[model samples]
Target: MHRSLLAGTFLLLFTTAASLAAAGSSTGLDDEIEGESRPAPSSQIPLPQEGDKPEAENGEPPEGNVTRPDTREETPIPDVLYDISALPEPVQRMRKLLMDAARSGDIENLRPLIGTGANRTQMALGGLEGDPIEFLREISGDDEGQEILAILLEVLEAGFVHLDEGTERELYVWPYFFSVPLEELTPAQKVELFKLVTAGDYEEMRTFGAYIFYRTAITPDGEWLFFVAGD
Candidate 1:
């Protein structure tokens, strides 16, 4: 599989008015990142050419595999999420439960289910690299962790490209604007991509910094191995 170049590391700057009190909470208006406009044309990761691309290019899944219930049927492929229904039912169930644990910041809930294949919690948040639960508590410190968890789940569930299928772990990828060299996209496409990620603080990441999408690695049985940001 091709590795995306926009892999990035973020120095999480969290300043919230309250803790992550509820399992289902929003980052509140004042707490959310302000995404007024796209970042300056500075970061520079080039994209693949048009023709020599994978047969499944962010629009639709390959046929023959469309007999499942959750198949898109006649739907447009979303820019961030993949049609995970294409996966086995057990995987689908596990993925949902895993994301729920993340959304709620219930690390204890996820600990028992973590697969042995992926022990490095080195995917998101720059490098709170340790046990995934510890990584959550370290980054969130409260309910504020919910946003980080939500961001991760959003990316994992919606990544546009299914990079490859593996025996133990499956990989997914997305074109996070921060991961892409901002300068590489046409001004308009940058704006569109930024809008998709809810919001961000790209103005602070200009110069040599590159924002990245989370490359989520999960087991067929629904274990989240790693979910790191990449450029």
Candidate 2:
């Protein structure tokens, strides 16, 4: 009986050790897989946000520019801005206002771009689909949100270059899965895309196989609607 008890004890200890080993192995393997194909984290990295600046009454040079999201890792592209001059003056004005608010991460500043109370209407805000104020809070609180804001700003400023697998047409456009819908991504792109987009969008895209980024939709009348990113 004592021998049998000792044998049981040894088996339990061996099983526990094996379970731990399996867990560790699987964890390491997962990390390795994630590190290999995780959307390459866009081209740029994040920069820290700045504290509020004193108002620039009149044409004062304003406060020192907040260090925008760092582009240290991004391959340099030509500094060409899209021509919004042909757009209606109001659209131009609203776009400018929205760009400024996003760049500064100023929630109050977004008021002018968004409509007034009761009449206040913004079509959409985030990848997960939330309100503008909540969107502001989100980007304000998180570095990745800031990065998303920066990407939107850059796309607005200069048109984005669409990038697809094995394409050399690398225009000055924001990278996107060319032609293919977000819902139809191949197995490899799908794996790389898992954590890149919101879970809601990801699941939807998985069904659709095509994903679009830097999407800004305004009403035909020039009302600022929504801007969404990722898969």
Each prediction's TM-score against the native? 0.46, 0.37
lDDT of prediction 1: 0.38
Of the candidates shown, which would achieve the greatest TM-score relative to the real structure? Answer: 1
Candidate 2, residues 20-109: lDDT per residue as tens digits?
A: 223322222111111121121111111112332111222121232111111243544233234667545666766677688768854556
Q: Per-residue CA lDDT of candidate 1, range 35-115, in tens?
A: 221111111112212322111333122232111112234543323444777866775776677678877765567666554
Q: What C-alpha lDDT values do all the predictions have?
A: 0.38, 0.35
RMSD per prediction, one decimal? 14.9, 21.3
